[model samples]
Target: MKRRPRRSVPATLTAVVLLAACAFVAVAAIQPIVGETPWVSYRSVADALHGARWTDLVPAIAGGVAALLGLVLLLTAILPGKLTVLPLLGELDSGASRRSYRSTLRAAVSTVDGVSAAKVKLKRRKVSVKVTTGRTSTGGLADAVRGALERRLDQIVPAVRPAVKVKVHAVRSAS
Candidate 1:
């Protein structure tokens, strides 16, 4: 399934507040405007700047808040995310979650003939695969799993394909 990007919590909250403010203004002014006496005046950004003073307590607090907000935005933009959202076919973002991508990878690895089973783990920038197969086929099977997943990843997440690592182990049997 394709995933749609979600606006963050802050963004959603901002939208809600703006919508409420607009609605309140419209309701409050509707009667006055209909009676030919407009009741509200809008503040411009320039007005705020004109009133701002460095020594003023309110403006100083407001400026500090603005600076903190900017810092948060900068950090989030500069740092890499734990797991990247993969772009889907013809879509900007996938509707599926990271776990879905892991499952898809697990399926791809299991398709190999000798791979008895497969486990997939997704890390910050890597995908690790552990497969179980006979001792004699360990090396080749591990290589095959890695190769197959690498190709599948190209289709699943074309952007920033995480490094794929595969390991094989023989299942123990009680003698």
Candidate 2:
């Protein structure tokens, strides 16, 4: 069984924009037919569209904006987003929430020696570890943190193993 990533937020936003535009146009059209003042004049809109030439600046700008929007929407639909739930190594099809996974990895990293604080960020196929320590020297700390993270990951036994990248920062010693 394959787990699918969450829907693209840009795609959702695009859908919402399209829905709002359609609703606005429908309301404007219906108000004129129902003997009410429309927010936008349908006749004026038709005249503006008909009178505007493709070579005019206004029409050219509008066309460029529309084309850009379309391209963004197309890319959003085509790209795969980050997974909300990661697959676990189990026979019964179990999974773990991404938040929990990150927290677990953070805890494991924080337990390492000389690591004062740790932050873990999980991307599509990578784990970023940022560590802060007060030891003044950060040599080998990143590698140690990476090792701890890998050990924790091995214990958790997720179906896929992501590459780990660790960054360490050392605080000034109060000597």
Candidate 3:
């Protein structure tokens, strides 16, 4: 089974929070109509809004939050999904996941001469590989890894083309 990509964070959180708020609004609206109910904390909304200074401040803060939430939701809805995978050439149906991309990059770096281990992190515009190189010549590992990655990327053209950066940390010889 194929898993769907997740929606934006603010959109998901805002939807859940707004649904909870609706329940509160429903109870608040019906409180005044429910005669002789102990839950009737206020005589009317006017009294609730007119009294304490905190009441006005609370609503103002809530309004600000609500406005920001609304703006984010609109933007997320209008914007296209951020694609992290590269598609197979001439085959739109076949694509690679970002996780697999990072894994392959790590494998590529680890295979390079003098590289004892490697860790790769994929960002929007850059692929960062941190490697522990053994007590051997390490001048060309970075270039080798970068070349391999570029070749891999050329093979599978992703939506975003990120530059590669390799950081080689020398492993200390244990006495």
Best by TM-score: 2
How far is 146's C-alpha from truth in model 2 (Å)? 2.3
Q: Of models 1 and 3, which has the larger TM-score?
A: 3
Query: CA RMSD for every model?
Result: 8.9, 2.6, 4.5
In lDDT terms, how accurate is model 2?
Answer: 0.86
Which portions of model 2 miss their true places by more than 4 Å?
173-175
By lDDT, is 1 or 3 better? Answer: 1
- What C-alpha lDDT do the candidate models reach, one value each? 0.73, 0.86, 0.72
Model 1 steric clash total: 3
Prediction 1 global C-alpha lDDT: 0.73
TM-score of each: 0.48, 0.81, 0.69
How many collisions per candidate? 3, 0, 0
Best by lDDT: 2
Local accuracy of candidate 1 as per-residue lDDT tens digits, 31-92: 56677554544445458778888899998898899899778866755655553455455455
* Model 3 agreement with the true structure over 1-175: per-residue lDDT tens digits: 1234567576668778889889877787686677545354656666877775854778789889889978878877776564555544454466677788778777766666777888888776788888887755567777887887788777667655788887877786545
Lowest summed lDDT over 10 consecutive residues: which window, candidate 2? 1-10
lDDT of 2 by residue, 1-175 (tens): 2456656577678779989999998998799789999898878889999999988999889889999988977777787666777988977788888889999999999899999998888987799999999897778898899899999989988888899999988887646
Candidate 1 residue-wise lDDT at 49: 71
